[model samples]
Target: MNQNEAVQQNSKPRRVSKKKGKALNNPPVKRLLLPTVVYLIIATQIPFIVTIYYSFQEWNLMRPDKGVTFTWFTNFIKALSAPSFYEVAMNTLILTTSVLMICFVCGLLLALLMNRNFVGKGIVRTMFISPFFVMPTVSGIIWKTMVYNPSFGFSAYFANVFGVAPYDWFTQNPLLAVIFIISWMWIPFFMLILLAGLQSLPMELIEAAQLDGANRLQQFFNVTIPHLVRYIEVVVLLGLMFILQVFGEIYVTTSGGPGFASTNLSFLVYRTGFQSWDVGGASAIGVITVILTIVMMLLMFKVLRRMFKEEQA
Candidate 1:
């Protein structure tokens, strides 16, 4: 019996030998990781860093005669001097905040509805989520051609039925038009994330709240909303990031204008860099965008930390 016990002990799995353990972190794996890391640095990190560096210069990206001379914030000064910059910045911020607010609120309601059991739920979920799966470019094109076309759009058809004008959208209130397009495209994403968060919440807590005389609103406010705060932060931040990056919608729907009316910072960057090939000014704008994003992220993180700390307490 002792020998059998000893044999059983010996039969238990052993840790890998030092050589094998080291081999597990093999050179081949390191080699593969190196290329990916390098690619990321080259494709994203390095270019971003270079853009920041060039934001202080006056190079036109084409004028070899001007070359790589630093002008010590003069590029940024020029960017700030552009009359359209401030308006575009404000428009971008307004669009981003408005889109996030509407999408998140509507998403929460839709997600709550989706969480409940119902017939044809799967198909319904797919339908609701389909917008998020569609490419941004495609979404913009469809909205531009099918939904906002004053002459033949769905809106025009409805307006004609009601004896009202089709009401040209992009030509008039272009900012509102862009916001609607961006919000429509992003609402599905918000719904998916919020729904997952809602479904993953602890059921016992909810039931306990109910047992303690909490009404639906009370339970949601006291328990559910507090619990979902983290997920809510993530959704808001993600929405802001994506919305700030909105260019295709602008490109397709309004081309950043009947004038500069619909131009956001991203579109501004595109116009400066590509359309006019003012690389220095574009880099400056890019740097400003990066700074704004970082500021927003830091602010959100500070708020998030406070909430989580309170949650832990």
Candidate 2:
């Protein structure tokens, strides 16, 4: 080829490459996306930063006359040593663990049942999922007034018909009562997720298992549960995130009351900040809670990662 023609050909390709690169740059999407990122950072991080700052200082709104003081580590130490701290921690552990266990097991069973082709399946599924849509506050109030109330509730009426007094569930077994309420509210959530997982499972693999003389139970244990590890992990992590912040139910039903019987970390923080007006102490608790939650998430992610690797292998 002539030198001038070759140069023109090379220059044309470069021009086209530049045009393609320009077309790939999505400035409008970036412009819309970056502001959202900035807004989220500002909205979430500012309060977190403020809480951390106050955690190191002594500021009790209730005792303003005593004046604000910078007390490093005192609030943390006090929170640790407080007589009710351990009770609150235990309550938190029990509440989270019990609710998760109940929800997971019940959810799996319900998902399995719903997976089958049966009459009225649509109605059953709609009814099963309805509770999950109810607001937590409303759920708590319904349980408190319509179910558990000893004076004029369903249980009371039933007991009256049998000539026996209704047992006061909240007063007698506060933690268990809270667990039941929370579990009822959360089970359908897990059920929906697990049902989706079950439906998405490969039918060919299931048929192969059946051909290999694997019964339903064996296939479920060996094939189904293994396939659902990732889904379970998703449910667990999301459940923990929401469960750790449980407040409305406790607020409506127990008020963390009759002592620290049902008071978890979140309730304790609320009580400290708003009720007791110990802003610094509450901030310290909030910081500790954030740390604990982060640590828990990291551990769970590590375990799930290992499980994922094993499944792949």
- lDDT string for model 1 (103-132, tens) is 998899999999999899999999998988
Candidate 1, position 306, lDDT: 73
RMSD of each: 6.5, 7.6
lDDT of each: 0.86, 0.89
In model 2, which regions exceed 4 Å deviation? Answer: 1-32, 161-164, 303-313
Across 58-96, the per-residue lDDT of candidate 2 in tens digits comes to 999988798889999999999999989899988998999
Give the least accurate 10-residue stretch of model 2, judged by summed lDDT.
18-27
> For residue 161, what is the lDDT in candidate 1?
99
Native-referenced Cα lDDT, model 2:
0.89
TM-score for each model: 0.85, 0.88
